[model samples]
Target chain A: MLRINDLHASTQGKNILKGINLEIKPGEVHAIMGPNGSGKSTLSQVLAGNDAYEVQSGTVTYKDQDLLELAADERALEGIFLAFQYPVEIPGFSNEKFLRTAVNAQRRHRGEAALDAFDFSAMAKDKMALMELDPDLMSRSLNVGFSGGEKKRNECFQMAMLEPSLAILDETDSGLDIDALRIVSQGVNALRREDRSVLLITHYQRLLDYIVPDYVHVLANGRIVRSGGKELAVELEKTGYGWLEDEAKSGEVAR
Target chain B: MKTATPDKSLTYRDVFASGQAEEKSWARYAAKRESALAAVLDRGLETRGLEEWVHGKAAGLVAGDALPVRGEVAAAGSPEMARVAGSHLLVFVNGVFDPARSEIGTLPAGASVQPLSAGDEAADLGSVARDVESSFTALNSLFWRDGLQLILADGVVLEQPVELWFVNDLAGEAGLIPVRNLIQVGAGSEATIIERFVLGQAAVVEQPLTEVVCAAGSVVNHIKLVGGEAAGEHFGSTHVVQRADSTYRSWEIVTGGHLARRELHLDLTESGAKCDLNALYMGAGKQRFDLRTRVNHDAAECETRELYKGILDGEARGVFDGLILVARDSQQTSAHQTNRNLLLSDDAVANSIPRLEIYADDVKCSHGSTTGQLEDEALFYLRTRGFSPEEARTYLAWAFASEVIESIPVLELRAELSAVVTRTLDVVDDTLMGELS
Candidate 1:
């Protein structure tokens, strides 16, 4: 469902993603773990079409379409969703209105009739239940004055509403408490399907306990140093990335 | 050849005689005009070179002849209007009041709407006639053809709002139309009023002068909306006096006009009185929007708060000047004024000045003005949510402006203004203009 090749990106003339190559098929989950300032979030932003980063020499393909060629909204219409690390607080725009607009934007792109208020409300109610979100929160401005856990759950609620084919969770677990982590994981798990894929980017292995990944990769110095099964996350959590740092330095010296 | 002092020298013939109109209304208010014009000329149109009026300028008043209107005068209003039920409606067209179109039965007994031509201004206007000292006020005084006078007798509680709809149709000719209004609320009375200025297809201008007196223990709320296809140049002056223990709230919302300037003056005369002023101005193209407001607290225990927001796009220019004054005897007075402006394009310009003069040592007075571009962090966050760059910019701009727009007490009008802001931002898919019409 998603592919990246030689993804070389920079911001302000400073290279963040040196060279990245990744491929993931449908119904599979991939976890990318890295420490702070390791270009993990940059990769997610570049994929989501954030214009601040310069993609010097890279191409990202989502569901066989060149994602880089499309605008940010077009990418979302093409079923690419990026759950932000810190959700934005948009005043004067209700959460329900935002979700309805996003849903209709995708539907319009797919040549489907837009849902009216009643139909949209019905769909929202069903999804809100699945995400364990309070209905009152939908009436207030989007994410304004929302708690950290509430914001994270709201992001997952939006993902459920839009039902994007390729979802990128960037640091979604960083600010979540244990209970919120479980709820978010449950929400993500309920949305999994045969034709959908998810990329979980995180800095810890605790979230893997709830939502096990099919493949795990450790990113170091802007490149993936190792790839293994879900057990690798547990191993890294126990021993830390000391060995991976040494391996990266030795590899750089060999070159 | 005598030196003209600001208070009592100079004549209207010196400043306004265009060598065109053989009959001018400046004759009616000559005493008022001579005094106000001398003050204006001495102040010199608010230039940087002057001490006061330093922030004043003529809003694109050209040196051309005042053209005559050629379009069909808007038909008289109908008494059977159903759009807004239970509203005290006063309708006017081309600055002429249409009694047939007005539905005034909604007003409680003792409140009356009278035309200036029906009786003597001295008897009808009462104390309101003595409050005109500005040139704009004097100009309206001399040339005002008809006015809708609303007076609420003491202790009368008006349940319905008074809607004064001013419709100007310049079908073909580009002309100037001026309006004058006086509203007096009696002691312990409360009322809400709306002054709507609508321009038709022709190019024209509407300059209105208004004076409001809120008696002791009374409350008043007023709103002004300017919109339409007519290329209009609107200049308005509003002077309000709040008696002891009275409350006054005013809002000015502008959407469309060629050139518009609004001057708001508020005086707190009695102790325990409070005033709240809020305004929103949106400018596109070469349109200029200017707002000047001054609040004077003359007695103790008076409070005032003001917030003015502006959004400028294209080559538009916006000017905002707010002044708060506390007299020496007005102790325990609290006043604050904030002006925030957003520049959407490189060519858009905004000038903001917030001033405060306090003679009372124990008073709380604060003023601030800020101009800013879109927040980069907020923009990036929106973009990451799949919003286009333009959409993100529009959403952020609306969020910045929502604080002032949401303050309108009337829910329907507040929603309509929101839709206006949305269309002004060029985002969103729906509009409320059709419904308003």
Candidate 2:
């Protein structure tokens, strides 16, 4: 469903993602694990079309179309959803209202009619129930005064609401309690479809135990040096990325 | 008193003289009006050098040639007039109270509504809103032909709000209309007063003065709505005095005008008194909106809260000046003031000044002001959700001002104001798009 060819991106003349390549087929769940400052978040941001990051040289194809050519919002309308690492707190805007606007925007892009308030509320209530979020939280300002776990659950709820074909979970497991992680994983697992793809970005292997991935890629020093199955995550957790860094350095010297 | 400019003062003097000749029974009040006018003429129209007039240019607004008095126009109600449910409506045409149009229904015992020109009543008429300080207030007191007097005796709790509707249909003539309202709420009484203005497409000047006295333990909610079309100018002042253990809340919403200036002065006199002042103003085209507010905490344990928001589009200019004062004996006084503005166009201007004066050492007082364009992150967040750029901007601007608009006590009024705000955003969006094209 997605292909990255020699993805080379940087910000302010500093290269972050250097010569990275990956591919994911339909219905596949890919997990990218790395240590701190390993360019895990930068890869997600670059994919989501953040203007702060400059694409030095790369080609990202989504469903056979050049994804980098689209604007951030246009990419969203094209069913590319990025669950932000830090959900923005929009003061004075109700979560329900923001969700409805977003849902209707995608619907309009797909040539569908806008849902009325009653219909939208009914749908939102069901999604909130699935995410185990209090119905009252939807009436409050978007992410304002929300707990960290609540913000993560809200991101999951948005992913459920938008129902994007390609969902990028950017540290969605960060700052979440065990119960919230379970709820978020259950929501994501329920949303899995044959024509959909998921990209999981995390620093720990704990989230993989809930929503297990089909393939695991270890990103180190702006490049993916290791690719394995779900068991590789458990092995990496037992050992560490330190050995992989030494191996990559020696392999580069031999090349 | 000596005048700096004789010709500038004579213009107002001649207008006051003609107004006095029409109403002979106002002999006792006329002396007070003459002195107030003389004071204004001596000061020569609040210059920009004054602290209060620093952001607002009051000279050009006051120096216009006095228009001839046109006959009374019809009281044709427009769609923009806000109609409250179960309200006692009092209609005024061209600043004169219309008895036929007014509905002075069966009021509760101890509650009365009468024209100020009907009888001699010591109802604190010119006590709260002194003429010496404001030229507009002085001009209103001098030339006002008839004014409304609302009285609520002690322990009277009114369930229905009293609606004061002023409609100005000048029909292309340049004229001046002075309106005065004196409201006195007795101790332990509760009442809501709504004043709405509807100005037609004409070059007109309206000077409206409202004085409110909240007795001990009473609650008063005052709402003012101004809607102007074309080149109408409005100079409005609301002076409120709160006694011990009383509460006063005010909401001012201005949507349209060529030049609109509103002054709000609230004095918390006795202990345990509380006051809340909230306002939302929007300006488009060459419209200019100015709001000046002062809250004085006189006794111990008094509290004051204020939030003012402005949205400026086109080449509109908005000014917000808020001052909170804590007297020496007013310990434990809690006062907070915030002013926020949203500028849509590059040429649009917003000036905010929030000041605090605390003579008491033990007091909690804070003031803040922010003026900037819409947040890029917020706009992007909204856009990513599927809204167009225009839709995103409109939603954010509406949300920015909704914080103050939602403070209205009446749900119906709040909904009405929300609808008005939405329509206003649509217009602003269209105008901005037009400018871009």
Candidate 3:
């Protein structure tokens, strides 16, 4: 469903992603685990077409089309959704209004009829239930005065509503408590399908317990240094990223 | 009749000979009119030298040929009329009250609506608005031929709002239309009044003055909407006096004119009185808007709140000068004032001056002013949600102005004004003009 070949990216004259090569097939769930400032979030932003990060050299193909050529909103309309690490707080813009606008935008792009307010409300109610979000939260300004967990749940709620083909969960478990983590994980798991793909980015292995991934890749120094199964995450939690960093350096020296 | 010259000072001789030739017919308020004209002759127009008029060139603009009175009636069913339907309307064409066009027969008992020419029974003519130093108030009082007088008796409440529509159809003539309105709400009364001004496609100078007297325990809401396609000038003054335990709220929306200037003065005369003054001004092209307001807390335990916002685009200029005064012996007074402005273009200008004068040591007062452009982070967030850049800009601008728009007590009126704000912003920002469609 997605392919990345030696993705090289930078922001503000500083290189971040040195060489990222990854691939995910249909219905596959891939996880990227790394320490702080390891380009985990950068990879997600670059895929979502953030102008701040320039792709110095690389190619990203989504469903057979070049992804780097599209604008941020165009990418969103093309079924690419990024659950932000820090959800933005927009004052005076209602969550329901934002959701409907986004839903209708993608619908129009797909040559489908727009949903009226009544239909949109019904659909939003169902999705809110899936995320365990209160109905009152939808009427309030988008993310304004929302708790951290509520914001994360709102991102999950939006993913459920849009039903994107490819979803990038950028640190979706960073600020969540145990209960909120479970709810958010359940929300993501419910949306899994044969034709869809998921890219999970996280620093902790706790989220992996709820939404288990098919493969776990350890990223360090802007490169994927290790690829393993789910046991690799448990092993890293027991040990630490320090041994991995030393091993990567020793391997480079041997090379 | 002598034609007034633009360079010469606007004196009483020029106003009387040029605009007030028929003043002798208004015999009931003759002495008041004479004094008001004398005051204008002594002070002339509000000059740039005055502190209150420094940011606005009101005297220079009105110094030109004294506005000749035009009485042409606007066509029925004009688009402007349709914009303000579903209200009890009192129509005034070119400063003259037209009973035939007014729908005031359905007023509830204990309420009275009449033309100021009816008699002196309802005339507090220049009582509350006795600011002799103000040239605009003097101008209106000197030549205002006829206006509306609304009075609500004690303990009475109006279920429907009264809309005073002032339509200016000058037949393409450059003239003056001075309007005077007197509204008195008796004790324990409640009412909402709207004053709307629509100008035809002419260069008319509109000088309007409204005096509101709120009796003890009364509540009054006054809304002023001034705008239209006409390339004209407007100078309006509203004076409000609140008795003990009374409440007064005023919402002023200024959207259209070559030059628009407004002054609002509110006085909390007795204990437990309260007042709220909110305004929004939208300026585009070379249009200019100036607003000056003062709230005086005269008695103990009075409260006042003031908020004014402006959106300026193109080369438009906006000015806001507001003051809150807490006099001695008026302890426990609480006053808050804020002025916020958004400039869409580099050339657009906004000047905000907020002042507080407190003589009572035991009072709480705060004032602040902010001027800025749209935030980059907020813009990016909207774009990521699938909205085009234009839509994002429009939404943010609308949201910035909605803080004041949402405060309107009337639901339908609030919606109408919200739409107007959107359309005005659309014109200023070309990128968002047709994005909604």
Candidate 4:
């Protein structure tokens, strides 16, 4: 359902993602793990069409459509969701209002009638339960004074509300505690469907343990160096990316 | 005959001469404003200057000789207007007192509505209005023909808010109109006062004065809603005094004004008095809005809180100056002031100045101001959640205003003001595309 070919992107004239090529079918979950400055987050941002990053070369297709040509909001309406690493705190905007607007926007994009206030409220109530978020939190300003774990859960709550075709979570487990991690992962696992795809971006192997992926890709120095089954994450966690760096060097020497 | 753009000092003089009989009685205070204008002219409109004239100028207000008195008022208001309880309802047309348009229902038991023009029976209470007179107040006192005087007997509670409607429907060119209001709440009496200003005529500029007084141990809730012809220009002032244990809360919402400047002064004279002042301004299409306010904590254990927020787009300009003064003997006083603005265009400008003058050693006073554009990260977050860029911006802007809008007591008025703000921001329309976008 998603394809990236020779994707090269940069931000502020500094190259970040270089020659990235990947493909995944529906019902598949792929995990991208990398060290600091390895372009893992950059790939997620580029895929979500963050305007800050400029695509120098390459094309991305989602469900047979040119994803690169779409605007950030258009990509979202087309069922591409990116759970930001640092979710923004939008003061004065209630979570219920935000979620309703988002859900309706996606519905409208899919040629369906937008949900009324009552319908949206019912849907949000059900989804809030799924994410274990308090009703009071949904009534307050969006993430204005939310705790780190609350922010992660709110993001997942939104993911559940929008029901995106491709969900790319960028470091969703960074600041979460063990309990929050379990809850967030449970929400993600519950939302998994055969017609949808998930891309998990992380720096550790802990999140992968909760939401096991079909494949694991090691991203180092702007390129995917290795791809294997979910066990590759546990192996990398044991040996670290230093071995992958050596393999990259040896491969370069051979070239 | 049309005159050259008059100087700020001379402008006050013109307004004073053209004021009504009540306003003329306080004309002697013009010297103080004249001196202030001279200081501003000599030192210039600096950010540090707390002068009202300087702040008015920052709002792009050009004082005219007189306000055009179109003499038009709504013949009949909606049922809600009748439902609102008040000791008296004094309506004005083009700043002229219109007795015919007012409806003074059955006064609360032991309450009276004494017309200021009808030989002041309670002349002693008039001293507060006369003693604390500024140039604008003096002008309003001189011009106002008839004003509402509410007297609540000790321990009376009035549930309905007293409504004062000021209509500016000047079709022709008149300038610098002044209006006055004197409210007296008896000891341990409670009441609510709402003032509505509607500009019906379009003109090059408008300068009007407004004065108010809250008596001892009385509670007053003042809501000022401004909506007028798109080209309306307005300059007004409200002065409030809270005696021992009295509470005063004023909410000012300005949606459409070519150049609107309002000055609010809260004097906490007696111990245990409190004031809560909140304001919201929505400007677009070259509109300029300025608000200058001062909260004086003179007695011990007084509290003052203020929150002013603005949303400016197009080439609009917003200026807000809030000052908190804790007097030398005002110990244990608590004062807080905050002003925040959002600019939607690069050309839009917002100047927020929060000033605190604390003389007491044992006081907690804090002030903060912030001016910024739409948060890019928030915008991106909303977009990724499927909201169009325009819809996201509008939602955020409205959300920012909801903080202030919710404070208005009148639900219908608040909803209308919110709609006006949405229309002014061009964020929404009746069309489905507008909603979707």
Ranking by TM-score: 2, 3, 4, 1
Best by the DockQ measure? 4
Highest TM-score: give the candidate number: 2
Which ten-residue region of model 2 chain A has the weakest summed lDDT?
Answer: A246-255
Better of 1 and 3 by lDDT: 3
> What does candidate 2's lDDT look like per residue over A130-197, in tens digits?
99999999889899999998898898899999998899999999888899999999999998999999
Q: Give the alpha-carbon lDDT of every model.
A: 0.75, 0.82, 0.82, 0.74
Task: Give the distance in Å from residue B113's predicted Cα in candidate 2 to where it truly belongs.
Answer: 3.3
What are the DockQ scores of the candidates, in order?
0.31, 0.44, 0.45, 0.52
Residue pairs in candidate 2 whose N, alpha carbon or C atoms collide under 3 angstroms: none
Residue clash pairs of candidate 3: B67-B176
TM-score per model over all chains: 0.82, 0.90, 0.88, 0.86
Order the candidates by DockQ, highest first — what do you get? 4, 3, 2, 1
**What stretches of model 3 exceed 4 Å from their correct place?**
A235-255, B1-11, B17-25, B59-64, B67-80, B83-86, B119-123, B171-173, B299-305, B327-334, B356-366, B426-437
lDDT of 3 by residue, B112-182 (tens): 87777774555476888984857667777777777778889999998778888887765454567788889
Model 1 regions lying over 4 Å from their true place:
A129-134, A177-179, A238-243, A252-255, B1-52, B59-86, B116-133, B170-178, B199-205, B215-218, B243-247, B269-274, B297-305, B325-338, B355-406, B411-437
Write model 4 residue lDDT over B1-437, tens digit each, in one string.
Answer: 12223234444435444532234333333443344334433443233344655655623232233332222322343212332434357776555456676777777797766444443444443244442434334334434444456667777787777777766554444444455556667778887777777765545344444344555677777888776665667776676778888888889888766888888877789999989999998888888888989888999999998999998888988899888989999999999999999998898889888999989999888899989988877788788887778887888788788778867776666666667667766754453234422
Candidate 1 vs candidate 4: the lDDT winner is: 1
Q: Per-residue CA lDDT of candidate 1, range B1-437, in tens?
A: 01111211323344344311432333444454455445544433223454435665654332223322212344543323232456787787777667777677755687876654443353424244333344344445544555567788999888877787777654444555656777888999998888887766555667777778999999998888876642767777777899999999989987677777888888898998999998888898988888989898999999999999889999988899888999999999999998989899999999998889999999888989988788776777665555667666776777666667777777667777777787788764342122111
Which model is ahead, 2 or 4, in terms of DockQ?
4
Ranking by lDDT: 3, 2, 1, 4
